[model samples]
Target: MAATDDFSKDNILGEGWTGTVYKGVLPDGSILAVKQLWRSSQSGKGLQAKMETLGRVKYW
Candidate 1:
């Protein structure tokens, strides 16, 4: 859990049809917006595929 603590109600920044966004701070003090996707919204394989696609995009 990268958040100031575990993803608690106090850390929730917003919610949407896709998932919930939480405010997080890394160990080095870098701020981050963390999104927790709903399990029912996408299958594990589908998520893996999307992550792979994003990895490829990063190389461009």
Candidate 2:
């Protein structure tokens, strides 16, 4: 099953805070949700904030 097989509009499942999730069909016909992240401009400070958030999650 390849990732490309499941990326069609017809299989969309849901959306969330960050992006829309689509139900993808693998080459073998397995189902999976692929989250598409919305594009945003990230400044240095913003990137640092994200890194801090990730670190916190890792520690938690």
Candidate 3:
């Protein structure tokens, strides 16, 4: 779907402390939003900690 190129200043929908969202349009004119999470390379949160946090996420 070429999502990388689809996200641009013109497609920005919104943003927050965790990440930014971009609106994407399809060939058929359908619209969708992409949320790219914000993570720091130097957050000091180790792999174990990250895994633990993810494990706690309740996805229904």
Better of 1 and 3 by TM-score: 1
By TM-score, who's the top model here? 1
TM-score of 1: 0.60
Candidates in order, TM-scores: namely: 0.60, 0.47, 0.53
Per-model lDDT: 0.74, 0.60, 0.65
Q: Which stretches of candidate 1 lie over 4 Å from their true place?
A: 40-60
Ranking by TM-score: 1, 3, 2
Clashing pairs in 1: none
Better of 2 and 3 by lDDT: 3
**Model 3 ranges off by over 4 Å:** 1-4, 40-60
Quote the positional error of residue 22 for candidate 1 in Å: 0.2
Q: After superposition, how far is residue 37 of candidate 2 from its true place, in Å?
A: 0.6
Better of 1 and 2 by TM-score: 1
Residue 5: error of model 3 in Å? 3.8
Most lDDT-accurate candidate: 1
Q: What are the runs in model 2 whose C-alpha is more than 4 Å off?
A: 1-8, 40-60
Better model by lDDT, 1 or 3? 1
- lDDT of each residue in 1-60, candidate 2, tens digit only: 146344566656776555566766667866555666667566679767855774564311
True-structure RMSD for candidate 1? 4.3
